[model samples]
Target: MGLDFSVVPEYAHFLWIGVVWTTVLTVSAALLAFFGGILFAMIVLYAPRLLAWPTRFFVWLFMGTPLLLQLYLIYFGLSQVGIDVPALVAGIVGLGLHFAVYNADVIRAGIVAVDPGQNEGARSLGLSRAQSFRYVIIPQAVRSVTPPLGNNLIALLKDSALVSVLGVAELVHASQLAISETYRPFEFYITAAALYYLLNLLLEAGLRAVERKVEATR
Candidate 1:
């Protein structure tokens, strides 16, 4: 259907607020997930079998489960066990952890993609293990993984909407509230979808720019 100018004009400010919330949630969640994922990736890459196996299990568990179910478990299921995390915290942690699991694999692949000879060169230079990793291996791995990592980040941005179920007042939540009051399902949902699309488009463009910059430095 055509754009509902009447509803759009009336709710523009409200929708802008929702977009801001969505951006905040997405960026915060992405940062959390990236750090967590990198930590997990390091463990899997360098830790002993004993440590790596459990880490692997965690990655599998989070990656295997549906994100929506994970959110519910954190927000609702935990409350059943008398562990009450606030809705916002649960939402951020759930999505961040979930993305971290998948991003771990991508990171692992990036590390693996780095030339084995580079590690050898670092070792031959009398660099310690940590030095070698910090200066050589990780740098290349990051370059190799930038595209995939950015894709995961963008996915995380869109997935933030799943947290709306917990009433986080994000974009989807704002749209739902508007729909409830205005009784305009089509307008609200279509607007929400368009906003999400715009978000992804902008993120993709940013990632492309980053990729180019990284490539130039290489």
Candidate 2:
């Protein structure tokens, strides 16, 4: 069938709403995953054996599985156990948990990359372990991990498409609906892809600005 551009103007508003939801999901999931990753990294690095083992297992379980399966388990499988979660909530949680595992590794590597001497110097100043980590270690680690975190943010934005399966009405889901209604899959999907590309470009620019600002402080 010949491609039709006419549907573009008619369905632009519908797709715009999808873009907003996609942005919301991506931001919310990124923030949730980032903080969770920090906590997981801390637990793996400093917690006692009992706590560390479980935390490591949590990371392994999520990291080893496909994210699409994770989303299904949360959104659909949970309903089987009489625990009903909203589609959007499930999508956010699933994405957050899945990416948090990777984020934990990035954060942990950043923490490890910081020189041991720095922590020793902090301790020599009579700082407690917690204080040394807070004042000396975390600052350095955050700077080291900023780029990886930015990359993860972009990945999260793209992965947000998976949530469309749950009927979350994000970009991909909206595109699917539009195509089904108008039989113009190419037009809608291409538009969705372009929007995603535009978002990633903006995200990359913002990340570069943040990276420069962080470097200035160093």
Instruction: Output the number of the lDDT-best candidate.
Output: 2
Each model's C-alpha lDDT?
Answer: 0.88, 0.93
Tens digits of lDDT, candidate 1, 42-143: 999889999999999999999888999999999999999999999888988998899988878888888888889999999999999898988998888878
Candidate 2's TM-score: 0.95
CA error at residue 196 for candidate 2, angstroms: 0.4
lDDT of 2 by residue, 70-185 (tens): 99999999999999999999999999988888999999999999999999999999999999988899889989889989998899999999999999999999899888889888
Clashing pairs in 1: none
Collision pairs in model 2: none
TM-score for all predictions?
0.92, 0.95
Compare the candidates by TM-score and give the number of the best one.
Answer: 2
RMSD of 2: 1.4
Per-residue error for 95 in candidate 1, Å, reads 1.2
